[model samples]
Target: MFNLSYTKSFMIKQKFTIEVKIIFLILTTVTVVISLLILFFTTKEKELLITLGISPKEIELFINRVSQELILFLGITILVLLIILSILVKKILSPIFKLSLATRTVASGNLDYPIELKTQDEIGEIAKDFTVIERSLKATIRDLRERNKEIELLSKITTKMTTRLNSQEIIGLIIEDLTTELGYDYILVSKLSEDGEYSQDHIFSGDTQMKQAIEDILEEKIENIKAPVSKLPFLPDVSSGKIVIKERLADFIGEVIGESQSDAIQLMLGAKNFVDVPLHIKEKPTYLLLIATSKETITKHDKDILHTFMRAASIGLENALLYEEKTRWADELEKKVEERTKELEEMTAKIAHQEKMVALGTMASRMSHELKNPLAIIRSNVYFLKKKVPMELMKYLDMIGRAEERSNIVVEETMGFVKGVSLKKELANINDCIEEALRSLSHELKKVEVEKEFSEDIPSVLIDVHWIHNLFTNIFINAVQAMEEEGVFHPEGELIGKITIKSCVVNSNIEVSISDTGKGVPQDIKDRIFDPFFGTKIRGTGLGLSISREIIEKHKGSINVFNNESGGATFTVVIPIPE
Candidate 1:
């Protein structure tokens, strides 16, 4: 019940295992044979001398001479045997030693070095096998590297395609990316004709010579392209809408051209390995992507990458087309709305509603086209500046970025909604914007006693300047008309009517109260004041208060009305001041 140890024991498995035993056995056998020969001759000396028919005195001399020659001959024979055995051992195992060294060299990443051993035995066969393995390993590593390069190129193309939405721009980018990745000697993109032939509208990019050669090839086969590939030198990719690659394109083209019109194609394209991928947009095959390279065989994985890139370009082009269509619709609608505006009295209220939509669309498209570029620049610059400024200044940069984002949202809303009004928001002192609004209606409000109780210490709030100006003007106009009709304003320019506007910060919000000394909002329709098309005036559009409420809510603010205890109605507006 013990764990077995791999350590060698002294008797069972000695250090001198087989090699020492072979040397020991050889020496022992040689020594014992020499000893027996000397002992047998020396012991039979008397018998051998008498048989030789010589005197006993001469017999001693003969025996001594014979023993001396025997020992010398044995010495020379043993030396020769040792030399032969040394050479034989080295010859027998030399391929094995060389094979081991070559394996180590290959393992160390020296794949360019070759394994060479010449013999006619099992060892030679083993060396040949090692040579095959070396070749296979190098091919596998090369293939893996090529696959990784293709994947990286595909990722870069994806990044570039996602940032662009225009069709031609996307196609141009695809041509550039694919040409760079595939290292094509010739790249040609041609639109297909109504008869399914290759059209002349081809986009080609690559070497000048290769492009010319490809152009010649196309010209020669111009009248024969009845199908993607019908007796064509290069097979077309009609089956899958992808590329058809031919590794032996040079030979095929040479055969087609009758070995007359040939130049560097056979040499440059290295057997004319090429691909032809069809660029399909909205499921209609329109353009063909042709590429021919000198080196690097185009595999199926590479084709897959190219196909995916082409697919993205097609989608981007479709989106661009749809946007163009939407733009056209918006323009036509605006023109119709403009014609309707001139005849507002004759047209129904439904026409007026259409005017609102037209206004929104025209403003949105114009503003989006104008502000998108600058706003993007502002946001990016602010972000860059935020990184370099001190911690204290970061808050201001962040605020500026937020303001840009809000402006972009307004642009998006205009384009996204037909009846919605988009507002460009910024931090403004409500008192100043309100003053500007009242000034916009100065001639009408001249006779009214407009009192302002503005708080100078109030924090700045984010509100749309133009929209807030309109909101204040609408209220002032309503108040002025009411007072003028009620005889609250005297004819001698004496201001008898009063309009009070006050603003102050209240618990993280800026509140503005505009109160008028006139008839209050009717009790029955007080809740419907902000409702669209609910005005009681004969010519009022009824959209003023409704739009004002929408602009307030978009800024994350609120507005409501209350009956004054003294004599009029008060309109209260609350806007948050971001901390």
Candidate 2:
């Protein structure tokens, strides 16, 4: 393969040689023929003059003149021939000069340089060869440029796609590069379903109006378009790691979408050629990238570029999928750790609660046994003295008896709280229970006014009467004590205290409300009021409300305390009615 410069140089050298040869041959032949003609004409004239009896001096003069004129004519004729040969040489070499110029222009990277030479000679043949070489060089240059462009696009795709670890985002970037950088008319990415039985359209990037038109014709959103792999017969070929290119795309699209809609969609999109390339993950095809254009043809080099792009994209997709999986696993592991930590915390708390209850039970056990004996002896002595004492001392004895009984009740409450209470459920009236509680606190209720609003239609509740009585007793005692404390603090003569108790059937349950005109529970500690050993009182076991809550919960009921509208606090208890 001779380079253009070498070929041009050689052809120019050949042109020079051909022109020299023709000039030499023509000039030498002309010289020879002219010399012979002069000799012959001189000889014939000499003989004729001699035969006519001419003088030697006259003959010599004639011959001399004739020779001079002939020599001059031959000189003029040779000069003319030389002039014509120069012109002919220039004309013969004209096409070669043009071809040389054309070659130089092309060598300077101007493929568009015009080559116009027509002849019926070797020069013409050489010109034709030059034209062919020019075209071949043009195509080669164009191909090299195209390959460079493809390399550049691939470089961009690799840079952009590798940085993205999100599958959808990588897919989007692929579409953008294909359409915007690669100059494809449209790009669509369809992902294979997990079952490997369906390929669903995940992205479509193209003209907005064209996309809308396709969507409308299919009567489905672009993303929602899907087809079984079996229906699209070309997909298997794609899945098997082969690039599938289809012309007359309507028939192929008709297989997936419908025959009728395909024609309309093809028209709207103006897509004549379509190429589908497989996108692989873990060495298996998991997606298809479809590129379409309205152009009548796609070059083999273009398809090769598409294949290279798809390969890079497949690697990107695999990386993204792996990243997502890793993230999901990380999240799941974090959640599991959190759940296990919560369980351990709950178990630790439960064990601590059990230890605390054990300690409480031990204290209550010793206190109950120690206090009960002393209380029994004091009450017996008080009874014995009541009979022996005079009327004045009888009051003293009664006070002693009351003090001993209060001590006994305290011991019983402590014991009951430590050793959880057992219920003996029976059908009984809640009103009757309330009246009994108030009666038990009669000796202490003299300073406070008590009002009762009992409903006659109250249903009989199945409850442990003893526990219910104890629950009410604890609430009443707290209320009276709160009021007594309030009176002590009052700047006025004394705080006017009132305790109102109401019972009614509400929401298929026995709702009892006990309202007192005493200090209300503080807002900050409202939620914690039911907790064990929590209270506002300076001197108390703090088990009253806690025990009450436990008993009510045992009965499958609820008890809540809130500030009343009038003043002080209202403790509301609701016990569900038996069906």
Specify the highest-lDDT model's number: 2
Position 524, candidate 1: lDDT: 100
Stretches > 4 Å off in candidate 1: 1-80, 90-96, 112-173, 185-275, 279-287, 290-579
Give the C-alpha lDDT of model 1: 0.71
For each candidate in turn, the TM-score is: 0.35, 0.69
| lDDT (Cα, tens digit) per residue for candidate 1, span 396-418 | 88778767855764454444343
Cα error, residue 564 of model 2, in Å, equals 5.4
lDDT, candidate 2, 223-294, per-residue tens = 334574345443324545667877756456655554434434655446777777778788777776667777
lDDT of model 1, residue 449: 85
